[model samples]
Target: MQYFPVFLNAQNLDCLVVGAGEVAARKVELLAKTPATIRVVAPQACQTIQAMAEQGLLKWIQREFDPGDIQGQQLIFVATDNHQLNCDISTLAKAANIPVNVVDNTELCSFITPSIVDRDPLLVALSSSGTAPVLLRYLRQKLESILPARLSELAKFSDKFRDKVKAHFNNVNQRRHFWEDVIEGDIAETVLAGDNQQAEQLIEQKLQQDEQTEAGCVYLVGAGPGDPDLLTFKALRLMQKADLVVYDRLVSKPILELVRRDAEKIYVGKKASLHSVPQNEINQLLVDAAKQGKRVVRLKGGDPYIFGRGGEEAETLVEQGISFQVVPGITAATGASTYAGIPLTHRDHAQSVVFSTGHLKDGSIDLDWPALARQRQTMVFYMGLTGLNVISQQLIKHGVAADMPVAVVQSATTDKQQVVTGTLMDIQQKASEANIQPPALIIVGTVVSLREKIG
Candidate 1:
């Protein structure tokens, strides 16, 4: 975020390049792609720069850099090998309040150019803030290969009808939906195939038939364990399209920031034995929002069905005759365990894994301790930090050895992650001493012992 990305208007722009080397020539070429007036000043000129000057592409002043050279320039570029010269120009540009870029020097740059994927009107620009240039180049290549060659044609076709579509939809959300449909549907494909006439006809026919109310739907998305990167592609897309978002306590702040900016957000996060917004009320809230034709996103942490109560929510949606889709996410048992360097299941240590909820609706610690206390199987208990003493006692009472290995992971997969390991007998005391909080996963079995060697 050091350099805010913006597409500056280049029409009638005044641009200056203070070097005439090969690097400077590249910057000049990029500037020439726009309608800007470019001037290059240097004691020597490269072949490419000289050729461009002869073709009247830019004004090449055959002189060394001077303070007066930057006057009246809206943008400046310095790509010389002389560090002192670049720093001097950067200072002058700052004093005059003109945006400047010093090649390969982030500290001297007011702006850093991004690698561009030019699909004409549909342009994609990405940068790494002058760090990891090679990584940025690799990503740019991937984008070029995946993006359609004729995407520009589709963009131009959509641009032609933007005003007409705007006039048809009074609500901003409706306008967004219309454009999404047109761009993702058959009209875009027809335009990409170079059929302007057929594309226009298709758009017109679509508009004519779509004056009725659009039915509201719900997206049941899993935000994944703490890390925002673990979110599925479909989950992110639905989150961006939501008109209203209902999220839970386990959803990370970074994940919440990914929701639609203007979308109304309602929190129904529940803590142990305390429900902020009750389950029935949350279900009704979703039903009411959908009835009002608002696209709702029910964002839950981890896999929606894995003790996330996603099935309960889905049942309510079905009973109410509302349409909804589920987007699965990486559950805490998998994400947190892997990040904590404790594999849930391993070939030699454990052959199977089991996930269970530590806290239940009735505030009971009752569980099939006999089955969970068995050997050669990994046990992951979610939301179990508060009842750690009871969990350990029961397992030991139910034939589990007192020295059985155990690990507690807090806020796994995030910067705030903390891990505590000990035997089942001392794990409760160890967690208390470490002040481990809720929303933590308790792992049991020999897998906890693997951390010393591989973690």
Candidate 2:
């Protein structure tokens, strides 16, 4: 480490800036974000600095560098075109045992400001210690996206109850465990989700309890077709905290790899005519794991409610009275269709869209053929590859054209994705010729014809 990182207390801090041009203005703006008393001395001030001073943001001593400026200042920033003047200010501040930062000059400085991400009471400071500034900024942008905006509120909420919680627990270890449960449990989640009232109630209820229950919650997260990038922030967060992950076959390998490193995983995905793990067994697994105080993630491919039997699992959770949260993911049809350059509904080609499962239940794909055969409407079928011949014959028999444009998209949104476009009469043959795999989507409509144009 080139420099040790410290979050200096800004309350009642005395800050001094020896220059007032653009570079100095940037430093002033950062200091202004805190409750610091600022004094800037410069011969000529930029418009930004002048505006800040006019608005009572800081005290501007409109004069050249003065040794008096360093007096009583706890922190000093030297940002001047004159190298000698910056060096002189740095020497004065360092000799007085005050921290000084000479912008762009590391050797003359006592400390350097880092790229800061401010979330009120919660702040993230990242630095390369004046080296690799651009890389530091890039890292800052990444952190901004991953960090929640309301994290400050969550931190404040915890702070408000710290003393009360400490008093409630006689042992320090017990208090530490309580805080762990609060921050990692639903209380912190509800707070971050913007339900502070509910969080407060939960916290109060927890305090009144004689003992904390070992019952853990379940998260039904959609893996979003096959793309790892398509996972939601909530989904990612829950996945990382998972003590156990129950995933499906359709969930891509890349997406599956994102689950918590130490989390236990079980594959309950079904193959055609084969049940790897029965649906009822899978439901029971979730309830049992959660009852054992395991943070369980029931990871599903695509939208779970959409043919993924997510409703079945949710009903089971409800029946068992297990606390759970559902994080939605992009369904296969929409994701696959778009990546194949086949819009589900277009102004001229498709007026409406219908989603159906071609997987036969009891021996036949029992869909309303007449409604599905409507013109100018796009038809998407999940698990349709096996019943492609039946689907084609049924649609054609139900007044649909045999030459209706069709597309079969396999592994949608992934590097291995493949799209086979042909007429309904010939798509099955084309798909077979290319050896298109399962976990594919069938998009049927004139929109499939636009693949050549838009794709």
Candidate 3:
């Protein structure tokens, strides 16, 4: 959190750049795309800067550095060859309460230029507090490769429908839900495919569906591992139809962004310290939201049934006699193993796969030692962070070999993913060294040895 990010409207503003070298030329070029009055002050102007000045597009001040030159500017850039001059401009600009960038001199500047991803109406600013611009630029390049060129058009398309959605859905909450439907709906898919006609048609159909599905219903959607790309078609379809999305903390942010921007997002995520919404209350909230005829999506991170407590949620929905659907996603065990390059059940190593929770019914590590101690079986433990040591010690105590291979995968299937492998006797130490935290999956057994084979 080195630098606070803020978007500035440069249109019709006074912008000043001091220096006319290559660095200053770049700053001027970036500013030229915006509707701003740009003035450059430098002893020698580059060919591009001079050309702009001759065309009446810019004012060139061919002179030495003057402190008063930046006085009337709203935004200023000091890209001079002289470090002292850049420092002076920065100090003067700060005193005048104007934002200034001293090229590469971060310490002398009040403002630092961020690595920007411009998708016209959609801008993503990445900054490492000016300390790691190269790394930030690398990340920006990666993001640019992944982001579609049609994002601006899609954003404009949604904006066009904003008024119509509000006019049709009188209630604020219902309207918000409708927009979420729009984003997850066929409209987004069609727009992304460059089919405006189909997109509009999908929007119309969504409105009709919204009217028809007036009776509240709930969809228990598993988001699938950490990748939004891994979400099931049914899960995505339901998300597109949601009026309100109540999601857990482990669900990835990029996946959450896929939900409608206007939709009411309620985070009922429970982490170790933060409990915004408790389980029982969350269940009741869903029931109440569904009763109001609003489409509610309970977005979980992994398969609803696999250590997700989805069974409990289903029971609540059934008892309430509420219309509900379950959308299965890739469970943590399966997803982690797949991406970590470890097969949960290798034919040569493991005969069967067993999924177990390290945290027991009493909120303690109470695994069946004999069952887990057996060799030649793949063991996937979910929510094992709190009980890793105990689980490890018990298995060894129950005749399991201390050298049994184990792999701890944190945030599997995500860009921040890390796989740390060791034996039961040393896996915890490996995890500690790697700083492996929850929102993780643990694989224990001889099958973990398959990493060597796969690699």
Candidate 4:
């Protein structure tokens, strides 16, 4: 890092700006956001700065720079167009042990302003240390999009409860654990969701829960289907307090973006033939993260319980007696069904719906085809892309009509989503022609015919 990050106590501090042109005016405007008393010294002040000075918002010195301008100031800025004056101020500020910024003149600057994302109580200051302001600004914009607007309010909310949480939970270790839960728990979620009343209620309940449990636990979160909009409010709420997120491969990028930026993100993503991190290792990672008194969110694609192996992860948490809860999500089947205009279950079309995984841990389509076919209800198959041929054949042999309508939805809820409808006999071929792949949903039943009705 080229620059050391520090939050200066600007309140009551004297900060001097030596120019009042647009560039200097911009700096002055940004500094006005803080409580620091600002002094802008320039022979010519901009209309805005002059207006501010007239309104008593700032102290303006309409005179040329004197050596005395550098005296008694904790921080100073030389935003003038004169390079010589900037260099002179830099030398003087350095001699007085004061931090000085010479605007764009990095060579003369003792300090440089960062590309900042201002969330008031939750500020993110990004600096390339005068190396790349454009790149830093680009990154700042991306962070602004991903960060919730209410984060500042949430930070303030946390400050309000800090004393209560500390005093209520006397044991330091226990208090630490309790805070992990509070941050990742409902209070943070409510703020993010813009539900202040519920957030406050959750905070109160969390404090009560802290009193009941000596040590707090963790939560394994299912990030839901690909679209962040499909995420349950509960799931999004749990993410605010995440100290560590163990994410899977199929988890969406936007969903990962919702996690706390400071939270540790560990990729536990697994592929069909390639395991980046094995299932057992993922289980251990979750356990280890929680044991450290950190709020661990095991972010998986779709509903964690539905072919997500979330149950297996929960077992590991249970074995260790880790305090954890499962927040369900819009599974691939539901997400695909809705996004593709196919309902999982309809009173007029189908009485029931079934969700089945096509591929097992051993990479085989081991399922009861006969019973699955005889049910005559809508069957939503997840991870069935690779095994589509066998799935179609099995259902046909097991009394499901070869001509039964079928629909394949790939990359459901995403911009690249594809939807294909055909008979069971040719659905696989049709899906192949459409280049449908995994991380998809397949619905088989007469209900597939209703996509036109719903459309």
Candidate 1 lDDT by residue in tens digits, 133-217: 9999999999999999999998888889999999998878788888988887899989888899999999999888848678889
The TM-score, computed over Cα atoms with residue i paired to residue i, of candidate 3 is 0.69
RMSD of 2: 9.6
What's the true lDDT of residue 285 in model 2?
A: 99
Q: TM-score winner among the candidates?
A: 1
Model 2 segments more than 4 A misplaced: 1-137, 140-209
Better of 3 and 4 by lDDT: 3
lDDT of 2: 0.90
Per-model TM-score on C-alpha atoms: 0.92, 0.60, 0.69, 0.63
Worst 10 residues of 4 by lDDT: 209-218
Query: Is candidate 1 or 2 superior in TM-score?
Result: 1
Given candidate 1, what's the lDDT at residue 429? 88
**Number of the top candidate by lDDT?**
1
Superposed by TM-score, candidate 3 places the C-alpha of residue 332 at a distance from the truth, in angstroms, of: 3.8
lDDT of predicted model 1:
0.92
Model 3 agreement with the true structure over 340-372: per-residue lDDT tens digits: 999887678888888898776668777787887
| Pairs that clash in candidate 2 | none
For residues 252-369, could you state the per-residue lDDT of candidate 4 as single tens digits? 8888889877778888887676789888888888887677677778888888898888899899889988888988887888788888888778787788888898888889998988
Q: What is the C-alpha lDDT of each candidate?
A: 0.92, 0.90, 0.85, 0.83
Which stretch of 10 consecutive residues in model 3 shows the poorest summed lDDT? Answer: 205-214
Which structure is stronger by TM-score: 1 or 4?
1
Model 3 has an lDDT value of 0.85
